[model samples]
Target: MRYPENWVNTKPGLDQVVKKLSSLTSLEFKLTDALIGDALILFEHKFRNIGDILINAFTIVTKRDILSICLRELLNPERTFNHYDLFEFVINVIDKPEEKILFQLEEYAIENPMMDVFQDNNGLIPQACTILKYPSIMYEYMLVKFGTKSRVTRYLMKEIITAHIGKAKLIKFYPSLASSVLMDFRWQELDYIFNTYCMAGVPFEPEFLPLVKTCPSDTVIKCLFDGYLSRLFGFKVEFTLSRVDQLPIFNIIPFTHREHNASSEANKEKVEWLNAINCNQYEPITDTFRRHLEKFRSRLRLNLI
Candidate 1:
């Protein structure tokens, strides 16, 4: 026999079941066990009605065994229902006037912040971002329950941003999150962050430059040069393979040289040496070195005041 296509949307029927389940104060354990068995049977039939009934009843009247059974069933990957429906049911419970149910949902989101409720190829990241999309959902349920700027929220944000960037196509969907992730100080992820920032056309901040300066990766440097500083700031910096014959030989100099001529050609050679090897090569040099370099000839400009 074919099951009813709208079996999952039978809220009225579920509400009746919830009422029956709630009235079992004397025989609560027996009723709950029976409900659990019925819920499992309904779930196997792909009818979420019994599950909804059990969840609503458990939320109103707390029973550890029943709640655990419902949660285990909710999290089961083999369940026929999709995450959107499950999320809707949870949200409905959260929105109810009853504080106990809302509190339970809040506690659940905190404990299982990265729950595998969704079937997206991206896993929990999308569901996390969806929760974040509704800041009211975050502010009302998550923030109060988990506290502001909690580790769970931060972790979810990190995962979402990483997963979003991993799929090049999805980056455009979350431009603001992408930009925020780029501002992180962790040196290793800088290039990915920098490239995402450039791709999103997000405004550059002066704070970012100092962070990028700390990274030693050549790829990070090249990204800074080609992706951001060169085009965005309109600088003419380019990386090219220097010929073996053109490479300069190193010459040692005394630590202290007397009669240092700040305006002499000898000073230009010293500036060149510093620019060639100094970590701050990106910084502009004085007149003589500036004259020979096409890019630095035009004094470097700061995009942010």
Candidate 2:
């Protein structure tokens, strides 16, 4: 309710008032549209790093559209915040999922080259875990990122599953669940993805077969099989048969398993020769090459050069 002296007359006084009030995180700044707009403009012109204040203010704002405005400013190409700072701002503030805001975030991430670094295990994986912790955003977030047909969405879904299961096998998937922060929340999200979303008429993805087979629930598998996976059974068989012929390693496995089979003398010699050069059975070839190169360089006096 209070205004600085000259607040009605000068921009400087408004700036001072906005700056002082936005800084106090403990104060519940009941930000109106005009004040919020003024504060953002000040941030653009004079205080580029006051993102924390804006983030906090947006989080508590009664108007949902205000959050969208904050996102628009943050995603502005000319905005001063770096990718890491932008990421923190998004994670800290985005408690609700507005479809438009989700689209903006996904689009910016797809288009901005700087955003790539955060998609890795140390980055988006953990950050996503944090995002899913919010009960409000979890379902919408999953539906947007994992329930889509987009190639990027598929990759993100795979990454999250891989991070949780460590290996992609559904059989080993349940055992891999170790205790960690917000993991129960993550499981709930995964349960939705695997159960409700996947079962709903989303066309079966071939890559999903591996992940689907990992589920131990008979009902889950039965629903998936009757609904989506039954057709893939033949495709799976044919694909595996095709790959076996294409990959020589498959042949080697059968050969190794054959009864009375032993390494042929020629194969043993070849193995020894490979090991010799590989340095598992002798001094590394790099050492010999280094010595030879040193001798030759000495003869040519190239070492001095």
Candidate 3:
């Protein structure tokens, strides 16, 4: 996609754009840096009718260099300012009065899928999650501009969940708010959200347990339970029967063979045949439930084998 024609032809347009970018203070610098980088990369590749002025500006706005400036200026401990202001500034640059620049940045993010434009030194995923706390337009901007099903989305979801769990007090104060934010995203992504946030060695917050319990899908419920179980076990374990050999074996029998063997064997054969005929017509649901429980138990690293 081409840069807007008006942006290309304006007098000293590139300089004007750079000046506009440099004028960004605090968190706004992050957004400006991202946009500037996109512009620079496009100009460098000679993608469109970019002028010499713009080309020079692109050179000055190298990705690493801009990030360094951000770390030094806004994120530095010596700055004595609420660094959140930087977040606000970044949000404004994207959603500010000028629609042209915002559109250009959006287009750039789409065109350059491989560019780590929104990330920090560690990565864009974590940084974006941190910025999401600011309640800025950039949160939505980043989510929508980047394909939400992409690996980046999974990474971002993980980081966002991590950050949220790190600040448990916020979740406690506004449980509905947290839930609403999570609900805004597609449900298919819930597995990554749960695995990334809850299974990442963070302490389980009692308040968050309900969210997992209320999930509509058995798949997600399984994942949530797995995460909880992992935390409980202090390590990961595949709770499948085939993997039971890895766990401690327990040989406690609930009943003696003489007590129930004849009745149990007859009932088991009848139930198996019934299951084979009408898979959904089970009564009391005890057999089906017991079977699944046994399967789950077999997968657990418990004293039952």
Candidate 4:
């Protein structure tokens, strides 16, 4: 362990320290946090981009680190880290207006909203496929954003399956394997949202995503209060962290801090539209506007409690 001389060669020295600190994945969680915190203190006042270093350090606390901590806590019964804790930590580390864990985060919560961007057709799917190489990432995101109640997986897969992903019958594949496969690949538009890569297919939008002023959890909970909850079997649950910290509260929204509004006018046509997607019509979005009753969105709930 060494500290660079503070009197000179500050930038190079800072870089060296950050590089070393960021790669410390083998260390215990508390030690890693303490060491990184100490290292940053050495250069904290000397740099403009120290926050990025912090974000990188936190990101380095990978799945293995979190799991190790959780298993240890289960045996020891100390406080455990949840997705909310991790997300809040990420938010705390971000100083710039555009930094984020979610891609073009604005598009999901506020702009396109619900973290969904609609295409009249499958135009976005292929482009998304180029960047999102796995199905499971999308599945996890599906749980994260809209919860298990959301029909997005069913709809997204309708597009993929309609493109003839396979000729399996609806009776055989629709409910089980097909559903799971689509859930796995729902976040294929990762690059489009993040705008971090240069794939030939996806049009990279380098536009800045303004991080909302509200708590990220609040925004996330608000996004889940749609009419979709009505369609779910389980009322509500915590977010799951099975493999990589998946949020399991996919079935219900908390009454606390929820931004509620009046019950929206019952729009039969729109209800029917989502009903189609629920059945896996992939093109479930003929009338995207009416796909959801947005008037009192985040206000409604299907949980009978």
**Best prediction by lDDT:** 2
In model 1, the clashing pairs are: none
**Model 3 lDDT vs. the true structure?**
0.35
Off by over 4 Å in 4: 1-53, 56-88, 91-138, 145-258, 265-305
Which lDDT tens digits does candidate 2 get at residues 161-266? 3333332122233344434556556665555444433433343434333333333343343444343333222112111111111111110111011233234633
Q: Using Cα atoms with residue i matched to residue i, what is each candidate's TM-score against the true structure?
A: 0.27, 0.29, 0.25, 0.24
At residue 92, what lDDT does model 4 achieve?
36
- Candidate 1 off by > 4 Å: 1-52, 58-81, 95-154, 160-301
Instruction: Name the candidate that leads on TM-score.
Output: 2
In candidate 3, what are the lDDT values of residues 179-202, reduced to their tens digit? 445444422233233343334323
Looking at model 1, which ten-residue stretch has the lowest summed lDDT? Answer: 246-255
lDDT of 4 by residue, 193-235 (tens): 2211111111111111111111122212122223123323222
Total clashing residue pairs per candidate? 0, 1, 9, 16
Best-to-worst lDDT order = 2, 1, 3, 4
User: Which prediction has more favorable TM-score, 2 or 3?
Assistant: 2
Worst 10 residues of 2 by lDDT: 247-256
Cα misplacement distance, residue 19 of candidate 1 (Å): 11
User: Whole-model lDDT, candidate 1?
Assistant: 0.37
